[model samples]
Target: MAGAGLKGARERRVRTGGIELCVAELGDADRPTVLLVHGYPDSKEVWSEVAVRLAEEFHVVLYDVRGHGRSTAPAPLRGGFTLEKLTDDFLAVADAVSPDRPVHLVGHDWGSVQSWEFVTVPRTEGRIASFTSLSGPSLDHFGHWIKSRMARPTPRRIGQLLGQGAKSWYVYLLQTPVLPELAWRGPLGKRWPKLLERVEKVPAGDYPTPSLPQDAATGAWLYRDNVRARLSRPRPDAFAHVPVQLITPTGDAFLSERLYDDLGTWVPELTRRTLPAKHWVPRTRPDQLSAWIGDFVRTHEEPATRAPRPVAEAAVRSGVRPEYAERFGGQLVLVTGAASGIGRATAFAFAEAGARVVAVDRDAEGAARTAEMARLIGAPEAWGEAVDVSDEQAMEKLAATVAAEYGIVDVLVNNAGIGLTGSFLETTSEEWKRVLDVNLWGVIHGCRIFGAQMAARGQGGHIVNTASAAAFQPSRALPAYNTSKAAVLMLSECLRAELAGRSIGVSAICPGIVNTNITATTRFAGVSDTAEEKRRQRKASRLYGLRNYPPEKVADAILGAVLHDRAVVPVTPEARGVHALSRLAPGALRALARWQPPA
Candidate 1:
């Protein structure tokens, strides 16, 4: 049976544990099955976005848990929502959907909690090829964690225990007899959707369904049935048999990052991914979830002949810094002007963090060299593309090719720019146009083309635009350069505000003066002869050499900005000083701008 507006989805009802489960299927039945599970107080619609994405390559399945969505709640639901019954529901669904093939299990929140149980139990070993867990921990693992911390009673462990205890305040309330049900049936249920939208930045849609009040009321037993029982008498033998991937939202308010500290002891084959998102990732970040789940399932699926796949070099590389590896690993990153200067260094930084890098530059050889070194540095894959960022059509083609070949870019660095130096009176219109085209319009094109893809993907990504300290610290000799960088800085701030709701981060990296080749090629507005221009270039390059700030440091700042979601970052000492001065003492900066540098 299919609802009229349910699109191409096929719906079925399966009787499991005396409850009729509402199940929906998509894509070809012959393909491997990917079963997506929703969390508490939510229905199958929670996975609608992610399910469609996965359906492109796999047989996608989604079902309401025992009492949520269209599924009928068990009579006298107090003890009916145990992990055992949940596992039974999973088995029934798997047997009905793909009896001969194991399913790839992906779950978020309470779904993850139950799926962890499914993966660890011996009965479901061959039925589950892999499991991807998000935002929820196994109650058994959580309980053991609590017991160990309490048993040890050390200061650090106590702090962790207390921190997690604070986060789990809702669990305590949920366990109370009629209070939770009454609240859910009252104003709380009606307001929950708005609350999720405001707090988690989840886009409004047909989620939390009309059945939310009853679903949440009946689902309270999920905590009552399993939490205390599993925690107090935890199973020591609860270790996962199938491959497991953990996707952690760094900004989740309900779960502490420290909860997974001992996860390795339980999961033998584990891959960890961290996202700069809030709790409801399936709703707010479905694209990223689907991408990760697809990759994990494809890697672990049983080949027709049971042949082993070769381990990838990126998987085994120890070059990535430990802090960055979890966040950037397997992510696609594109850097413009990556042939040299800060762009190349930034590309190398992301590559070293295990991202797949696409290096773009007008110089083909230099771009190729950067890509080659990026592969050696630890990128899972790297490519070089020769494109001028100032050309709109070239950038559009580049964006299409990158998406078709490398998947959507998770991080975009609009680092391509040029240098121009001259007084306002002497700078010709052509010189101003040249600088603005590359510096301002280049950033605009990158953001318009690539940033749109990121937003349309609905996964959320980060964009880094290379501005200069001249954006803030006005200078007499660098009028055109300052104006272009100022526009870039303002664009970044505006984009940051606009994209915050989309979970896309925009950062303006303003480095004062770095040891880069921009100075060697900087245009001198008033110089008429080639020799004079060369003399000016050498003089500027020599002056910058004396002040020598490495581009590598600027690269480090770029990565840090992405990690911290920083808006405007000043890299070098003088940059930071000038930024401070521009804000704290604007008149002083204006006075300093009046001083003319040697020609």
Candidate 2:
């Protein structure tokens, strides 16, 4: 029975394989079971809402994968997070949760990969009846995607370099023993918003970052084994037989929609669904997902009571419309900081793509100007509002008014953020708090307010937060800025964990400088009085000027990331390079950063 007032789902700690996992559950055990698996750096809570939805039809089981969320890390944390080990853990949990009955399994991001492996494995296949993958890729398929992209001509060299670089940063960081620990425990942890913010681009809602220590070493271990190793090793032979459903958000940033171009080759029985969501698909687009899932089960599943549908009905009966259709036309979009840069450009881009736009900014006149431009660009509706991004109460009220007037907010872009230049010592306490309050907390409030409504409505929506290139890289000069962004990044990650079950989409945008007016408004130590500070900003801007990209391009990237439910996206050449190199060689990067900028 669906209870009138259910408390928040409770967590159950259990050991599967060699690791302890924190599992969450809802509904009666006698019902059919749906097991939910979360992806990298996240835990079981992400599936809470989705679990609740599925509980209406089946018992829902959600658990933090080993090392993430409330899961206990194994000793020698680095070795425990491999795909192989995680796959085993999935099997273990499946056996414990539903040993006799086949499980309806669902996974997002990294969890999808594990679910794919679980259904394909010879031993585990018996326990799985259906598999749903959200924003996940087969390791082999992903590897091929990267390689094929890299094979392009010299003109595309920049894109290749950028991808390599974005990937490199984390790999480079993993090579170190102490730096990762220091980062998690030291100032890096405190200034997390700046350091991790840019990496948090999901479409729906963001991942939440509780201001505390989490055992990241375990999740980092998975990267060391898979990403660092280049995913070259053969995946187990058992993965081809799973009956799978794949949900790809159109706006995914890290893994492009193009990644699914050849997915059918690997998954013959795949049922593909597309949402105008981002990487945080579970949280932002839960209602949409729930409805979609209901439809999918009705259309694709063979009922136990009724004999399988007649061949004619099965083959010819109509199903959901193909994603390429014009149904996405005229969706309403509210983008913050929509005067110039990604906000303004994204507003216009949406107009070009047939979306009604609500462009909000502190610069009322500038927002109006952007609205005018959107109308000229063919928007069905373009409106402007003046609001300070850092004002949480204001945003809450704005969200309420928008919902009341527009009915539902299909998309929200928390894109207003400030940049900084100079060392941490140069940063004042007020400056640090201010940056975090705006860049980090701004996103938090937006998600809490809009996300709650989206969840209640059950239609599904997307949230995109603007982070920065500094999210994945640790720099001494821009410590305060980096810290705030990092916190923003972690915040998105946590939300991805908490909100997926509801199917709300969350994306964090991490972009390098793209010809924006941020520098003009930027407040930093030594900018006015300090000659050295002024010199750094000038030199840095000059260097960045070499890559003078348009905000429209970044906006396009945001749309792509959301549509495909990509978790992490790097939007600049420098950002890509920094991300990749840091992953491959962190010490070398640290040394390079320490090396005084070439005089």
Choose the strongest candidate by TM-score: 1
Candidate 2 regions off by >4 Å?
Answer: 1-11, 147-176, 187-212, 236-239, 297-302, 305-321, 324-599
For 1-599, candidate 2 gives per-residue lDDT tens digits of 11111245545667766568766667777666778887755556556556667677666787777666666677776566666777778777777777767777888887886666676667765677778888877776666556655666465554664654574465578667677766766675565544333433232332443422364544656666676454554353534576777777765655666667767767767776666556666665554455445434434343662223234333222331233112233467889889887899888767665456889998999999998877766554578988887898898888888876654677778898887666677777788888887888888887888888776665567788888888877777678788888887778778877777767677878897778777655666645566665665566667656768888779878877766777778888878888788789888777766654442
Off by over 4 Å in 1: 2-6, 303-318, 329-412, 422-425, 433-463, 468-521, 530-557, 564-599
lDDT per residue for candidate 1 within 1-599, as digits (tens), equals: 64222368999999988999999999989888999988988888888878888888899998999999888988889789999999999999999999998999999899999999999999998999999999999999999999999889999999999999899999999999899989999999989999988777677877768888999999999999999999999899999999999989877899999999999999999989898778888887765677678767877888772323235444545655666877887678999999999999999898878778999999999999999988877775799999999899999999999988777788999999999888999999888888999999999999989999887765579999999899998889889999999999999999999999788999999999899999898988887899999998998889889998889899989999998899999999999999999999999999999999888
Listed in order, each prediction's TM-score against the native is 0.77, 0.50
- Count of clashing pairs, candidate 2: 111
Model 2 weakest 10-residue run by lDDT: 316-325
Q: Please list the C-alpha lDDT of all candidates, in the order they appear.
A: 0.89, 0.68
RMSD of 1: 5.5
